[model samples]
Target: MLRHLAVRTRFFDDYLLHAAADGGCHQVVVPAAGLDTRAFRLNWPPNVACYEIDAPEMMAFRERVLAGQAAEPAVARRVPLAADLRGEWTKALLGAGFDPAERSAWLVEGPLIHLEAAESTRLLGEIGDLAAPGSRLALAHGLDPGEAAGPDSEPGSGPGSEPDGDPAGAPRPPGSAPEEDPAAWLTHHGWRATRHDRAAAATSYGRPPGYLTPRLSYLTAERRPPAVAPAVQGRS
Candidate 1:
């Protein structure tokens, strides 16, 4: 399980860097940011702005910890917006100077599983709405051990109890089934997605396949441009 988490962390770290450097996405947004310190640790390009959104308590906790450590962000701009993901957090994000017209990179990790299926769909839809053409996204998707154990299972008894497990012991929400085809879901939302399975990721990272379980995977996607209607020729 520890190895699994290490691989997942490294994967997303690389994804964010590539999105900013190679993909030309200067604006980055991390929903359910929690205690993540990418804004401080990553080497962002010039004029890059990174937004971290989470609940009020989590935001306050992160601020206090960073303050104590005197941590300075590597990015040119780091904005921490305290807003609940299950609510209208987009307003707070825009008010914090997020420009939806510009291409952006989004990281969605460790949040969706805790939300109901409908809530998860709504969250992704909202993200699609904000993402402009050429925007990049990386997300963690799949069933955790707790989910596999069935909905009625206790939280701490499963793999979710580990340090890298479910955040804050939040059980996988009821009626939240894993998306069978995450790539298809992205395509439906006008994004080109590529899914990396656990085995492939482990091999890429030089980790043994036994280290990671097949139940979890990651998806990296880019928002496609809107389709234009064809012009009709007028009868002469």
Candidate 2:
């Protein structure tokens, strides 16, 4: 799931990085950055710096998987930050030399399920506030079949990978309200999003090697100021 979700070109994350590269955004931040090796694999420009933010345990797990491998990153600098996004991640990242004005790109891949609607608002609001005008965000948000519903809607929730000790553990009860309208929420926050359903994405990228799991849905959003859509203005 990790490899299939994070590393595929058809995924918004891949597009996010490509857009950032094209824009010459040197500083990049990845939240809940578990097992992600883009800094080590992608040919980041010499001027760029990459930050990985996640639980300390997740970072340690990645270290174990990458142990004894040539661990040099393609970028000139890489920073590791251990913190919970639901907490004071902004403070932790800033303390670790993250410049809010760095014209950075952010990836919140696989993050919304772990957050509440309010938490999503706070985190993303801060991101939108801090990001330079042209910075980008690539996110994955759970869909409420009721809203973005039509012939394109697909299955969600499964043998739930719920976290045991935390309240986020249990499978979301059957009739609970969705966190928020994924596309509308982001759009109201001045982000223009392009939605991609799971089934379409899997087909576009072909099947994952051995698993056909469709745990992720996508939103490829470019951080913009208010309604100044580059699309309407004929910009890419």
Candidate 3:
């Protein structure tokens, strides 16, 4: 699990940096931001704005830690909004100065697998609605090894049992049905997505593939331009 966490962390770090530096996105949003410190650790581009959203308690804890450490954000602007993802957080985000019209990068890591399918879908839909054309998204999810290996295989362990460790012994949520392909779901929502497995991630990070588990996958997608209606010719 430590290996998986290390690879996943590196993958997202590189992903966000690439999104900011090369993908032409100046706005960064992290939903369920938890105790993440990317705003203080990463070197962002000039004029970039980062918004981190999480539960009120989590936000307070983060602020207290940062304050104790006297940590400063590496970006020009870092806004921390206290809100719940399961609620109307979008309003809070916009109120905190997020610009929906601007191209943005969203990192939805470590939390989706904990949510129910309906909740996850709703969260993704909200993100799609807020994202403008050419926006980028990166997310991670855990897979059911038994499902991946086929029905004949033994029942696999759940995501909460993984080495990464769940917070406060929260019960593991149901696995998303295999038919609900994340890439296809994104495509339907007007985003072009690419899925990556553990092997790919380990290879990219110069790590051995021995730690590769069928338990996790990553996705990176770009929001496509909205479809335009065809114009009708008037009778001459």
Candidate 4:
């Protein structure tokens, strides 16, 4: 299971790195950032800043692990904000110099299933409220093994599928209640979402079959810009 998770994590991390870099975002946030070290590994733009949110103990442990390494962050600034996601996390994030007005990239990885349904909804709401137009969000979750390997798996769809096989509509294993469709949920909150099933994503990442379970899914969404009003013509 750990190996499967690690593989999926690598794929998601690669996607997140490119998405943030290509988008030219000045700020990036990784909530519940447990032990991953993209800030030091990726080739970030000189002007970009990264903020990691995690529990104090986790941050301390990360610091200890990094103290032995000679590597440094590629970005101009990498701030570690220690806070619990369940309580006043936004305040801590803002205090760490987050600018809600600025377009940013947010990565929520490996923590959704731990949250109850209501908690997950609340977390998404907070993120939606904090993000400005043009901001991007990446969400990932570990799934029960064999969940997506059932008969309904779509063939010939790549990880970047747009219309036909949105992961939100993909079939779940028998006896498993369908999850609240994350793409639809995000769309309701004004985000344009695209989902990639694990199989397609694994193929895209050049991993062999059995590298990851089909149950794992990734969704990338962007907050849409507000509509502009048409100007009224003055009487001639």
Candidate 5:
């Protein structure tokens, strides 16, 4: 678990930490939390809140570990919420007293592929709606057969026998990736953004040998602030 997670940690999630720093956000929410340790590892500001929302079992396990290690989170507010992402979680979260006005920087890593476009849209819209103006979101996006070929591209796994499939055949998809253009969809849905495409990620993240193929893309976007002033008729 540690070995597998370590690879994921450095590759994409590290970019989330970078965005939070560069964007100067005060709150962060990690959905489908898994075993992420950003709350303890990252140097969050005093007023910041880091929230982790995941399944009941995972939350319980995390709590048990933290308790065993007597880990007091280094983050200002370490909130561990046990709830399903695909459920009516807003009510549960809000009842737990999450403020909608709080601006947040978010990391939605390792979860989008497992979800539907509609489901991802609902989740993004909810977060976007709650986000205070000018807040940020960073996500790892799998491509949709663009200039950067997708998981179905049939590339070899960087000179290795396919550990999980026939070595001579196509590269495997990272569990149920959506064919839809999720990053573009999010942009149209109100996020003001830019993307780190496959080539860029390969250069930075998988440099030496380079990635087997950068089937993933990374993004960061800020919520559009409200109009500074409404347009007046007959201004000319």
Candidate 6:
């Protein structure tokens, strides 16, 4: 099971990184980054800056691990922003030299499930506001079959505690409303989203369908500003 998840995660990360580079983004943001090694492992161009946003404790832990291994990032600049995502993290990101006017890549990988739906939406809105035109977003929002039917069958109950899922003992936020299809959600909010199922992605990676169990919904969207109308020529 762990192997399956690792494969799926690798595939997702590779795809997002390539997509971002292809779209000419110079900055990349990974929210709630916990033990993520992409900054050090991926083959990034010297101009790309990767920011890992997480709590102070998490950053400290990651630093310790890297120090022990003497691991250095491959990217030109790797910034670690120690701030709570539920609070004023965006301020810290900006203070750390994030430029809202420049195109960037945003990755919301494993942490969205831990936030309430409204909080997740707000986070998305914040990203949208910070993103310049042609920026890219990659998200992994997996839905359970039970989530589609209706509200949770029991009060105060939530998704099962998968042992391999999320950080151990990480605080689970309050339960949220059922999630809308991410593609439609992104489309409604000024993005052109393309959704991909895990099976198809696994096959593309030359892996069997069984490689991506408990299928996660993966989507990549590009910010599309509304087009301006052409001026009338009759007066001229």
TM-scores of the models, in the order given: 0.83, 0.70, 0.84, 0.81, 0.74, 0.79
Could you give candidate 3's per-residue lDDT for residues 30-111 as a string of tens digits?
9999989899898788888999999999999999999999999998899999999999999999998889999999999877
Model 4 ranges off by over 4 Å: 142-152, 155-157, 163-179, 227-236
| lDDT score, candidate 4, position 131 | 91
Quote the positional error of residue 40 for candidate 3 in Å. 0.9
**lDDT (10s digit) by residue, model 2, range 45-86:** 667788899987888777777676858888778888888888
lDDT: which is higher, 3 or 6?
3
Residue pairs with clashing backbones, model 1: none
User: What's each prediction's clash count?
Assistant: 0, 0, 0, 0, 0, 0
**lDDT (tens digit, per residue) of candidate 5 on 18-113:** 556666666778888898888887666566678899999999999999899888787777789998889877776677656778667778877777
| Residue 9 lDDT, candidate 4, scale 0-100 | 78
Every model: Cα RMSD to truth: 8.7, 10.0, 8.2, 5.0, 8.7, 9.2
Higher-ranked by TM-score: 2 or 4: 4
TM-score of model 6 relative to the true fold? 0.79
| Candidate 5 TM-score, C-alpha based | 0.74
Q: After superposition, how far is residue 22 of candidate 4 from its true place, in Å?
A: 1.9
lDDT of 6 by residue, 151-174 (tens): 322211112222111233222232
Candidate 5 segments exceeding 4 Å error: 1-8, 11-14, 18-22, 148-179, 209-212, 226-236
Candidates 4 and 6 compared by TM-score, better number: 4
lDDT of 4 at 103: 86
Candidate 3: residue pairs that collide: none
